[model samples]
Target: MSIDFGLIFARMPEILAAFWVTVWIWIVSNVLAVFLGFGVATLRRYGPLWLDLLLRLLVEIIRGTPFLVQLFLLYFGGPFIGLSLDPIPAGLLGMTVYSTAYYSEIFRAGYNAIPVGHIEAAECVGLTRGQIIRRILVPEMTMLVLPQCVNMAILMMKETAILSIITVPELTLVVGAIGSQQYAFVEAMLLLALFYWFLVELSGFLGRIAEARLSKFRFAHS
Candidate 1:
């Protein structure tokens, strides 16, 4: 039997919605992750020991757990607590928290890449702590942060696949549903894989653009 391209086209809208869901998660989670990660990274670098330890402990806990387990716990277990969530929100929240912890280390490394001498010189010039961080450390670390931040954004896009486990109707979940309903397993999966590959490529392309922009200024990390 010949393949029905027209049938696939007819179902395109559903597929497109799934694709949008995935993109939406990526956008929301990346925004959240950047803020959460930056805050966590700052706490590690500038906050007191007690706050640092608490933040580090949270990071460690997240890093040690598998994403799938975390999703299950949040989706299935959260209702028992006061924090109930719908599929989409729950899935995005899981991805946000997961990305936040991992991205925190990357951002922290960017800050750490700045030289101690630069910070000391800022202090000697009578700049306050906020001034030193804003003018010297952060500016110097921009190049370092750019690559890892983009990479983390791309990684989060891929991680959105796990949301399918919770029936969020994102890309993977839609593909699986359509495949089963249509009995076109191979065809559906191939299309889904192609979609994901395109998404990743697009993200990588944007990252390269950002890297080029950041590379204009040479920050000596050594």
Candidate 2:
């Protein structure tokens, strides 16, 4: 069958609009996830044992389930529990919760990788726990785990397509609608792939820049 490049070009506006939605959701979700994950990791490390166990259990539950199922439960099953949410909110909530679990683990690993002597030295120097975390631990841990975090961000970007299943009007959903309406399945699919490819490539490029800058900062501080 012949491909129709014109059809893809014609739908560029809609595709780009949807692409922006995906980007917005991904950014918001991952930002919240990272901060919340860091808090979770910190608590697990230094908080009381019961709280750590509870957070650990929750993390494992989220990580163990499929994201799609999580989304469905939030958007569809939520009404039964008086917790209804609109599509975008549900998608955002689901994505944040799902990513927080993995991000917590990544930060947890970063915490473990820090030398104990560093903390001891900070203690000897009279830096409060909060001061040490802000002045030293956060920066060091960020440098150590940044590459992994970038990988996770890229994976999360791709997973935004799954939100389309919940009718979130993201890139994949818009493209699928176009395909269905115009019987241009191949063109639609190709365009969808192209949009995602661009997003993933752009994310990788930015991630590399971030890693390089963070590396320089880490060394300068060292």
Candidate 3:
């Protein structure tokens, strides 16, 4: 059977609107995940034993749960706890919480890879803790972890597609609605796939650029 470009083009406005929602949700949740993950990892790495254990427990609990279950708990369960959130904010919160758990693991791995001896050496040279972190730790970890972080970002972007399950009206929901209403499942789904494909390609291209720039020190050493 021939494909119908006309049907797809006719629905472009709604599709584009939904796509933009997906884009923004991905951006917001990713930013939150990266920062929160780093913060939690740092605290767990250097804070007291109690704090470390607590963070570890939290991470494990989050990781053990399914993403959809978490989303439902936040979106549907919020009202029961007197924390009524709109679909978008609830979805954002769920995504942020879920991604943070994984990003924290990535960060923890990066942090652990940096030798304590290097930090000690910096300290012996009379460098302040803050100076040591800024000059030594940050750059080294960025180089070691950029690739994994890029992969996590891509994964987080794909996870945003699931936000549609909560009526967040992202790409999947929009396309699915159009398909159901117009009996154009093939065309609607084809366009949806193309939209996600373009995003994945764009993200991969930019990630490669970032990885190359950030890992220049490694390249130079080799």
Candidate 4:
């Protein structure tokens, strides 16, 4: 069959709007994940044993489930549970919940990866626990965690597709609607694929710059 570049290009405006929504959802989710993950990691690393256990359980539950199911609960079941969130907000909330679980795991792993001697050195130098983690662990772990966190952020951006099931009108939703209307399934899908590829590659590019800047700590891993 012949290609229809015009058809695909014409539909891009709708897709562009969807792209913004997708970006916003992922950005807001990652912003929340940063704070939530730091707190979760700190609690798991140095807080009471009970709080650590609770965060571990919570993280596992969030990660073990599908994003679609989580979106449904927030978007559809929210009002039933006394949370009548706007559709966009509900989708954003779901993205935060889903991303936070993985972010927590990334940070927890980074925290654990710190060498025992590193902490001991800090302590020997008279640093408090908080000071040690802040001054030593965080500086080292940033090199370790940034790459994993960037990968997770890319995944979260792609997961915006699930928001469509909840009527959030992200990239996938717009593509689907156009594909149905134009009967240009292949073209529409190709555009969607291109968009996702761009998003992933963009994230990787940014991550590489961060990795290079943080590569000083690769010595730690070595």
Global lDDT for candidate 1? 0.86
Worst 10 residues of 4 by lDDT: 213-222
Candidate 4 residues 117-192, lDDT tens each? 8788788889998788778988888877888888888887778888888888898888888887887778888878
What do the candidate models score in CA lDDT, each in turn? 0.86, 0.92, 0.88, 0.83
lDDT of 2 by residue, 1-222 (tens): 988767766788887898889999999999999999999999999999999999999999999999999998999999999998989999999999999999999999999988888889999999999999998799889899999999999999999999999999998999889887778888889878987899799999999999987787663333
Question: What TM-score, over all chains together, does every model reach?
Answer: 0.94, 0.95, 0.93, 0.92
lDDT (Cα, 0-100) at 198 in candidate 2: 90
Model 2, runs deviating above 4 Å:
219-222
Candidates 2 and 3 compared by TM-score, better number: 2
lDDT of candidate model 4 versus the reference: 0.83
Candidate ranking (lDDT, best to worst):
2, 3, 1, 4
| Residue pairs clashing, model 4 | none
Q: Candidate 4, residue 132: CA error in Å?
A: 1.3
**Candidate 1 vs candidate 4, TM-score winner:** 1
lDDT score for residue 51 of model 2: 97
Prediction-by-prediction clash tally? 0, 0, 0, 0
Ranking by TM-score: 2, 1, 3, 4
Shift of residue 59 alpha carbon in model 1, Å: 0.6
Q: What global local distance difference test value does model 3 have?
A: 0.88
For residues 103-206, could you state the per-residue lDDT of candidate 1 as single tens digits? 89988888877888989989999999989888987777777788888888888888888899999999999887887778776677777788889989998998
In model 1, where is the ten-residue run with the lowest total lDDT?
A: 1-10
Model 2 reaches what TM-score against the true structure?
0.95
Q: In terms of lDDT, which candidate is stronger, 2 or 4?
A: 2
Better of 1 and 3 by lDDT: 3
